[model samples]
Target: MSRAQIAPPAPSGPARSVPPPPSRPLPPPPVVGPSTRLVDLAAPEQPLSPHDPRSVGEYTLTGRLGSGGMGTVYLGHRAGTHGVVAIKVLAPHLLDDVDARTRFLREGQTLQKVTGDYTARVHGVGFDGSMPYIVMERLDGPSLHAFVAASGAVTDGEMLTRTAIALARALAALHADGITHRDLKPGNVLLTSAGPKVVDFGIARVVGQTHHTPAGNMVGTPGYMAPEQVTGNGALPATDVWAWACCVVFAARGDHLFDGDNILDIARRILDGPGAEAFGAVHRLSPRLVPVLRRATAQDASDRPRDGAALLRLLDRSGATSAVGHAGWDRLVGGGVR
Candidate 1:
């Protein structure tokens, strides 16, 4: 069957709600013992070749930022403007895949719909032979994933509150532009000196794009994907919101809510398990934040907060607004928070 013709598997229970399993005594908090140190999470595992050629067009490569399943991201600078930026050069093997190229270009176009400080700004695109590349603003900060790993967990109520606000505002802009960021995770959020900036719009979908996945497949970080995304149905603004909640949960607890050996197993647990137990380990989290998290992580998209606005409202009601204001948000963005 063609890729577009594949159908997502049907969900087993009610779309809106899944009854929780019987309550058991809450588990004790996991021991917070020191482990091996990872001081420089932003440092690339391998240094960039100093002699690597610059982009064919206007930019010069300075250093490597990071590499992932798709490609290597580099720190680059535009010649005339001397503007620093990040560019993702698609993997050589992926250049042979028509679908992958199309998806990459789609991401560049869709990101234009989202405009805000919290979302990375896409500047332009270039090609080095058949390998397509995208140019984005250079955000000098560690990913939230790295921050959480180094700092243990974000137990400060004010920090979580501000982070939620920034993320919600960013998602609101994307939803307004009729785009859905299919992949939203800690690794994709950069904690800059100014504040949190969301990056990596690689797997997003515009409003009218056909949404389908190969059978028995899914395309998102396993622990953070919404139920619909996990089921391979498709993602919407609600899916982003669900992932946003998972991000907050990760920041608050320093552990993934859904634990499994692999993506498929994690998907099954999120679809079928009673997740209330997952929140129990987060003792440092304020009680007021629980309901907001619960709403954000609702099994059904319709049952979750309708949009970023609604999520922001819930956060406001939780009395986090005042704290965010006094927390030196500017200094945090300036790289002082770390």
Candidate 2:
């Protein structure tokens, strides 16, 4: 509930391990109060309107970054310092919902231990009056979702390969700390100058940790969620793998693997429909990677890569490493491998 934007339902199954696609930065969504828009990561910050809160505790709010069901995210600067941070303010109604607030705080705790180039570092946590808020490194980049919207699916073979590996590394770090990024999607991944950094840990959970979400209710985007998450069985490190595979395909094809007008349809297709049928078309694009993706998206979690680190190994062994290196990586973050 404290997660980033809710996405269309993803299908459940074992997906073969594959690389995720390259995406550009994301722009903020329309929400109540002062708003700002971004054309891309390099675009200047949109000035805050009169209705926007000037500050949230020690952070001086500068512009609206984005919003979702849980809260509004704003770009801010630390008072008297040049440090920039993205501020997420909890929704007013959820303030009274103990479970929501608890999860919000837990997200901070989960991310606090994760340190690396692949995640948005948690800077501070506090409240703006009755609203709980989180401060994070303000990345000068856009969400993969926005990038795809503007540039179409990433076509550079090397960029896609690098993105997949980077995200896999990020997930490996998260799982090492017992954190499951329950919601791993293009929109939740930000493409920055350094590389792709996973954002919005609002729905992340520790391995085997209990949750406040009701039983039988799904907790993640249907299109990107693992089978267990969709069926309410549970979330594991492999769950993120499944989502990562889906994202990879999306980035390559600029389309959803499972198509439907509603969640039920998507769920049914994932559970009962010919699973391979969905990926049939794209399978032709990169035949060699099909088997890897199949293993990652397998309906049975055991069939997939054990974790991000393992997935990276598979990619390396399978020759996905051919186009990856310092030069390729630079081209990846800089807009394509030459």
Candidate 3:
């Protein structure tokens, strides 16, 4: 006999009939519950749109990190490795423009040789048929622009000093390679777990290259842009320093160094006002930062710190000490700057 048929029953009730258990143990009570999907903390990018391309070159794109004037940036992993990479593909229409093609190719070639902890290392460049794309290591953090918007100003003195130092180091690395990052606004400074990594070199030019764009055509964000750049004097090491100072002020005060009702108004403020005017809202700021900002954002580029290395030396002389000790540097870097 089967076990079910041979099983014995419990003692009968004294004065009542007992109910028999249902055949075949009842399926565990239906699991009716709300959905509780766990989120992926590792992935910081947005989901790919239905129309987004699934693959680029040898990488399979899984998400869209962001889009820019030049092209779309997709998050993906190389076919053979689990490591994530950011694939920036030039817009299809730009492929027909000779200048655009030249600049896109030059950006990758320039970054290939420029490698350091302060830079987002370029992995490779290739063409998906007619469209060209550059592959770089993906950064798992927000841009300085996004961070400031969400966290307001970085009021901690130690944080401000650390950020300024990291950016200066990155700039020094770039200048060492004879490259001037034409676009050094807060949006291009990626604050990662490793520290600040300067990015977006599309408009960057070699130190001695002649300006090809028309004199009247201006580039870069006006508020943070150096006066020389707004007036079409062409980008130089000093231009980055000016923007860097503007960024420092913004991070410290939660306001743009030069603000106005419109782009023209902002441009006018940057062009017409002195760096001191931008510090009106920054009260109780450490006296040490005053001269640094003044010289970095001088109306005349010649009056500012000559280069990134010079800026560092100036900071050292100004008593802007590092926020953390040698061990603390690693701890702060691992946790990321505010």
Candidate 4:
């Protein structure tokens, strides 16, 4: 199929893709119930950091796992079930901003609605003072980004196939809930012993929510954004498919598909230039896969796969497998970042 034609931008260049109409406003935040806060009987005695003390209902904070623009994630344990959970504590400074808090809370609610082993599970949520925190299943694994960084480009066709399957399943679960994981980069995909688990839904939007992301405001990771996303058009399931294709390309070649001034520029190049040549150097990949990747990364969202399941089927048709027997999983959990 021919790629979607780009509309001209004002007087020159391709035309900009128009965003879908805003949906209804998201529902009010769910009320915190008594069960939401378990006893701190097994809570850790020491804080993960001096800045953010570890105390949220019954979960004890062990150490700081990671921090991002939104908040810090802590390794915590729940005494009730002896379960390890990752607690996401929003920055205190953001409490006053209703939009930020609503987005943060929406992440928790969105994950809770996604029921699948490929997706992270939300256990509970509470507050440490005005800072909101969410308790989630603590996954022992490195993000796909970290794995690629350590192992270099994944040349083994089998490993790439496994990763693709896990990710596709995760995306399928997300779409089933009427949710779109606007962000689908390597960093957001965690590789655990059980399997790959897709995490980080801070920028996700439910189908019917009206709080449309503003134009020119990008929400996903730069290198993985779809062409339409770069144009400031809102993302859909197809957008996730485009990013998924980028992930596959990264696995095969260990490089970005576009080299533009920024995400928007990259999107423009992918839409208008010979962007499919980015994967030319990867010899391990099947020649047939090249066309599939090109279509997945098509400038128009409509040109991509219908959903994650469809993507998974395409990857399966490639016939790839894992070279090492779960060694990647063990190394990821055991390796410490200094």
Report residue 33 deviation for candidate 4 (angstroms). 48
**TM-score-sorted candidate list, best first:** 2, 3, 1, 4
- Kindly report which residue stretches of model 2 are placed more than 4 angstroms away from their true locations once superposed: 1-44, 208-210, 273-288, 335-338
**How much is the lDDT of residue 258 in candidate 1?**
73
Local distance difference test, each candidate: 0.67, 0.69, 0.68, 0.63
For candidate 1, what is the lDDT? 0.67
Question: Candidate 1, residue 317: CA error in Å?
Answer: 3.0
Q: Model 1 compared with the native: what TM-score? A: 0.81
lDDT of 3 by residue, 105-179 (tens): 888877786856777788999999998999988775566665666556775566666778889888888887888
**Model 4, 258-332: lDDT tens per residue?**
556654576566667334367674435445466567667766677678787777666656543222255543333
Clashes of 2: 27
lDDT score for residue 36 of model 3: 12
Residue 108, candidate 2: Cα error in Å is 1.5
TM-score per candidate, chains pooled: 0.81, 0.83, 0.81, 0.76
Minimal lDDT window, size 10, model 3:
7-16
Error of 3 at 170 (Å): 0.9
CA displacement after TM-score superposition, residue 316 of candidate 2 (Å): 1.9
Better of 2 and 4 by TM-score: 2
* Candidate 4 or 1, higher lDDT: 1
